[model samples]
Target: MGDFLDKRAEHLSTGMKQKTNIARAVVHQPDVVVLDEPTTGLDIMTKQNIIEFIRDLKADNTPVVFSTHHLDEVALLCDSVCLIDRGTSRFCGSIEAFKEVGQSGELNDAFMNIVKQGTMHV
Candidate 1:
């Protein structure tokens, strides 16, 4: 188990620590995984690697719950998304449906439009 543990936590960079956490998280082979800001403070290459790893987990039939503040990441990796603002549900649906509502392909634009309209009550 020595190889599975992060030995460099004290000295490693933030991205390295994040990667180490990810490695540890998957080592147990669980059915579900929840990651919060898994790609935070990482470069583009490292972020891509993390994203791809999540994709692979999904392909293997593992249910992954990913929480991220990056809308672009959500747009790229999520099949369905629920946008919550001020503790209210703004939108809950597929990316395609969300895009249709705003008549735009950009997820951020759609999210902004929904928030602007204040249509997420309840």
Candidate 2:
């Protein structure tokens, strides 16, 4: 977090810049936080660290709203999910409900089906 305190956002590495962005977002202890693809373009290790940090936020009872195409991250971190297609909310419910919609009860399969068929019954 030194890069954040030092006022060196421009000089920071990509991963560090990402961390600084997360830090600033949460510094005020807001009731809810919104992030758009926080892990996009990050290395695997950095992505994992950011995921862990998000878990920490959850542990502290913070509500996080993030948009991502990374289904694996959703499986790991989300209790509920909202799937949108072409500016429409196709599904919004618990993870279990989403899994139940798939033929194989797999998130990726369900997501693909939703995108391809657009017939997921809510």
Candidate 3:
């Protein structure tokens, strides 16, 4: 967001580019926010900033649907969760119910157990 702001899009770093993209996308405050791996390659600070933005959107009651490999983000941000396995909805419900699925009360473990049960649908 420094000198890069004065430069062309091609000159920005991956994180900076993603940040700008998100900012531009949400400037109008759309009805819903959908992001794909939003913070995957961002720096810690940039990632944190984006996470806060997501939180702010939620606080304002804007529905946020983002795909992330970071389970911690899911734990911190989502009230309900959906797990897609091979283009199928393997699970979709409250976070607590999802936790119970794994029987260990852990996000990562829950995800694994869900995926491990390839034929199960909930």
Candidate 4:
């Protein structure tokens, strides 16, 4: 905290500032956490570290809601997915179910199909 702290909040690099913000979020041990694109703009190593942190949170049975454009991260960390587009939810189900929506059985393809169809399933 001491090394990263800056009076003007500009001394720290983007990654360091992101880490500091993350430390603040977890300091309280809250039951639920909502992280929006936590790995965005981070280096690959830092992104992996954050991903591991998220897995640790899951192991602790803490609920984490992460909104990201990175489908790979979703595959790694999420069991369920709610895909929303244009302020509407297009699909909500397990990751397997999501993959089943496409002929290729790939999450990205399924997502594209859902967007093209503009439909939702419970």
Error of 1 at 91 (Å): 1.4
TM-score of 2: 0.83
Error of 1 at 57 (Å): 0.9
Compared with the true structure, what per-residue lDDT tens digits does model 3 show for residues 78-122? 999999988989898899999888666899998999889775556
Q: Write the per-residue lDDT of candidate 4 for residues 94-117, one digit (tens) a residue.
A: 998887764447778888988888
Task: Report the C-alpha lDDT of model 2 over 1-122, residue by residue, as the tens digit.
Answer: 64357666798877777777877888898999888889987899889988998999899999999999999999999999989999877788888888776544789998877677676456
For model 1, what is the error of residue 38's alpha carbon versus the real structure, in angstroms, after optimal superposition? 1.4
After superposition, the stretches of candidate 2 with alpha carbons farther than 4 Å from their true spots are 1-13, 119-122
Please list the residue runs of candidate 1 whose C-alpha ends up more than 4 Å from where it truly belongs after superposition: 1-11
Best candidate according to lDDT = 3
- lDDT of the structure predicted as candidate 3: 0.87
Q: Which stretches of candidate 3 lie over 4 Å from their true place?
A: none
lDDT of 1: 0.82
- Superposition error at 90 for model 3 (Å): 0.9
Q: Each candidate's TM vs. the true structure? A: 0.81, 0.83, 0.89, 0.89
Query: Model 2, residue 2: what's the lDDT?
Result: 44
Better of 1 and 2 by TM-score: 2
- By TM-score rank, best first, the candidates go 4, 3, 2, 1
Ranking by lDDT: 3, 4, 2, 1
